[model samples]
Target chain A: MILTNIESVPGLRTVEHMGLVSGSTVRSKHVGRDLMAGLKNIFGGELKGYTELLNEAREEAIARMVKQAEALGANAVVNVRFSTSAVAAGAAELYAYGTAVRVE
Target chain B: MADIIVFIVLVACGYFIGGHRERSHYRSIFAREAATLELTLLSGKAIDPAWQVAQAALVTGVCVISVDYFKSVAAGLRNLVGGRVSAYESLIDRARREALLRMKAQAAALGGKVVVINVRLETSSISGMKADGRSGQVASVEVIAYGTALALA
Candidate 1:
């Protein structure tokens, strides 16, 4: 399967537009990670734990989106976009959406 | 008071340590940006038809950066005056640049000369908040950069 954020994939012509597919996931920080983040907050720097957690969540969201595209007989997802929102105090929702297409 | 003393110490530590880290991060960003200058990045949705493309794939980079105690305090003060919060500006700038560089590195891994098109950047604040939402603190900001990378033979 191929994924591209542009309208079409390079060197491949989109044969059919399979409408839109989307996936989302919500994650909350565990206590251990939160404690470490609190300490890191005092000094200001990259939150590696949070970064890795969110990265995994985002990838899972994308995978779910790809699964939907595959179900619709699409070979690729195009014009992909991502959005994130804080659902609760320490929980965040990551959403991935795109247009599924058959490219040849 | 002990609380006041702790606040001062935290602020001092944040100032000295955070400042040093920011400088080093900037140095690294500058050097890596120069090293990856060969990879072209574009926000336009379409690619030039003249170039022969070998492969195309999606590439993404993400960064979660937090503001130090000193900068957050400075920003809070700036908020009262309704002026530009310069303290937070550098944080956002660094996050965006770092995310872009990571995206470039991913594209370079695809082999051959790569041009990333349709680049999109999104920023969101991911800080814990109280149930009532009144105590929502700006602990960190997340920046995500994504695009389609086309490798040319």
Candidate 2:
């Protein structure tokens, strides 16, 4: 399916709107990763592990959202948005939402 | 006594190492931004109708940058006085620019002239709270930049 974070896909026309679809997931860092991050905090740099973890989680969330759109018989998802929240000390929740539509 | 000594050492290390990392990151960001100057990044949803579009797809970039011990401690002191916390300011700035740069790189990889539309940035603090809901010194900040990349025809 075509995905765009705009009102409509470029070079295509929206033929139908399929309401809204959303997916979310919460992830927590493992103890080892948390310990390493604690040390990295002292020295200061990119938390590569956490970055990868969050990115993977976001992709999964997007995939689930896409699945929902597909089930609704939508050909594209538009006006997509992502949000991240700290669910707990080491846990983070990533949410992806968009308007599903049929494009021609 | 020993704990105080370790605290001092950590602060010293944080000062030196964190400063170096920030400087280098800025330098790299500048270079990459210049390299990708031809690619367009926009926040508005409207796209110009004149240009022929070949393809459009979702693109995203994420960055997680940590604050040094020294800056967090310095910010804590600023909290008491109620002034702008400049140390955290630079941290967030770096994270944002880095995330955008990575997004631009992805746009460039789409194999043609491209413009990113409806770009949005989301920033959140991570590892900053405990199970008891008590917030600690912000260990790191996360920034995600996403948009629709339209390859020109």
Q: What are the models' TM-scores? A: 0.94, 0.94
**TM-scores for chain A, candidates in order?**
0.95, 0.96
**lDDT measured at residue B15 in model 1 versus the true structure, 0 to 100:** 98
DockQ of candidate 1 against the true complex: 0.64
Model 1 chain B: weakest 10-residue lDDT segment is B129-138
Write one digit per residue (lDDT tens) for candidate 2, span A38-101. Answer: 8888888888877887788789899999999999999999999998777666666899999999
DockQ of each: 0.64, 0.67
Task: Please list the residue runs of candidate 2 whose C-alpha ends up more than 4 Å from where it truly belongs after superposition.
Answer: B129-134
Question: Per-prediction fnat values?
Answer: 0.66, 0.75
Q: Per-residue error at B128 for model 1, in Å?
A: 4.0
lDDT (Cα, tens digit) per residue for candidate 1, span B1-153: 999999999999899998888899999999999999999999988778798989999999988888889997898788788888888899989999999999999999999889999899976445653334243544777788999999997
How accurate locally, in lDDT, is each candidate? 0.86, 0.87
Model 1 chain A, TM-score vs. native: 0.95
